[model samples]
Target: MAAVSLTAVPARADGPRPAVLVLPGGGYGHQADHEAEPVAEWLASLGIHAYVLRYRVAPHRHPAPLEDAKMAMLQIRSESSGPAVDPTRVGVLGFSAGGHLAATLSTAVATGNAALDVQAAVPDLTVLCYPVVSCTEDVHQGSVDNLLGASPSDDLLREVSADLHVTAATPPAFVWHTADDAAVPVHHSLAYTGSLIRAGVPAELHVFPHGRHGLGLATGDPGPDQWTSLCAAWLTRRGWTQSSPSVM
Candidate 1:
């Protein structure tokens, strides 16, 4: 098992703050750097503590990444007693396959597996950016293969698919995707949002008409770039953001 790393960014305030665990997308093969630090810094600037998770990826499978995410959440929550983070307010922000991992952490079965520690694994909220949400037709084949192997059983496929796992227990989610995302189709977000809504879980989804997959911050692109502000507002509404106004 490869060692996982957690990079923490403290809030500017002196008091404990809400935290967001950032998971970068890499099609389940690797972690994307752009999604890690930049995102953490953004959250930190917003007066929210941020932690970037470097979880195990491909050459690893199902439970590995999920376990890593759980560990990251626990680490952040464990700091609740200190001036680091607020345990009850910890959330997750993930991109693409990392989004899948985030959603998995949000919806996967606990199974009383001590290693999983499901009770501590649930995040207060989730924000998924162009996430790979399904294992069936709308799935990103590369992400599916990397995370579940080339010929996964139907049960395995259904089990890992985030949309299929959504229930009333699933956390509220704020999702954004590009309508033109070729790598991972937009239906992933749409389906997951629909499931969340049907389950009576609050969900907000945004579908931009342009941009490719893995756009990261989407930098200067006018339309897709609005996600940051939109997400900040959503987080604020969910109490994941700190009491202060969100930073640009």
Candidate 2:
């Protein structure tokens, strides 16, 4: 058996499966149990390397959480002791406010020789699990206010709209949300997906009928439980998940 520390789990012994880092949502004020560990455990069982990021909360402010996300991705990408970690197959999975962070990482980053200590951290694919898609419209009030302090500037507003920052260089993404979710609204997922489509980037969206916010993968529930199967299918289609074992 191999060790998978709670902080970060590297690519496992079987092979260099697609590494997925999970960011749980706590609305930037708190980090929840359902948002982190469960997702990692499931991904690990599927042979994907899973890292659970316990990022700095609201008092930390913008670019802080974003940098933490970048650091995590970089650490995984730079690890070379075992199976080669495929930076191209790397995916960032976030839920709720963490979803917002994932969106920021996917949209706001650019590659260059000047890549900071973060090492040009950016996932090849992003998965937003019922994410907060916008900083201005369809926004989560507490998250935005906490991220910006008071009277956020127009610049700050644009900074948070990950969709607005999308470029042809942005990674492909997949999104899911329940239509009945009033907490974050389905529009967040819709708007982001719309932007991805308009930019000619590949995106897949699933809007479940029920299941409001924070319904982490569970049994006998009407929430994100059904998402894993669909996600596996999408990964297979994108050639991210393995059909048969092979080391790179």
Best by TM-score: 1
Model 1, 13-108: lDDT tens per residue?
A: 766678889999999898889999998898888888888899998898877788889888887888644447767788899999999989888886
Question: For model 2, what is the error of residue 123's alpha carbon versus the real structure, in angstroms, after optimal superposition?
Answer: 0.5
- What tens digits encode model 2's per-residue C-alpha lDDT throughout 117-198? 2425878888898898688886789888766677898877877788787777777888899988888988999988898899
Off by over 4 Å in 1: 80-83, 110-112, 244-248
TM-score of every prediction relative to native = 0.93, 0.88
Q: Which candidate is the best by lDDT?
A: 1
Clashes of each: 0, 0
Query: Against the unseen true structure, what C-alpha lDDT does each candidate score?
Result: 0.85, 0.77
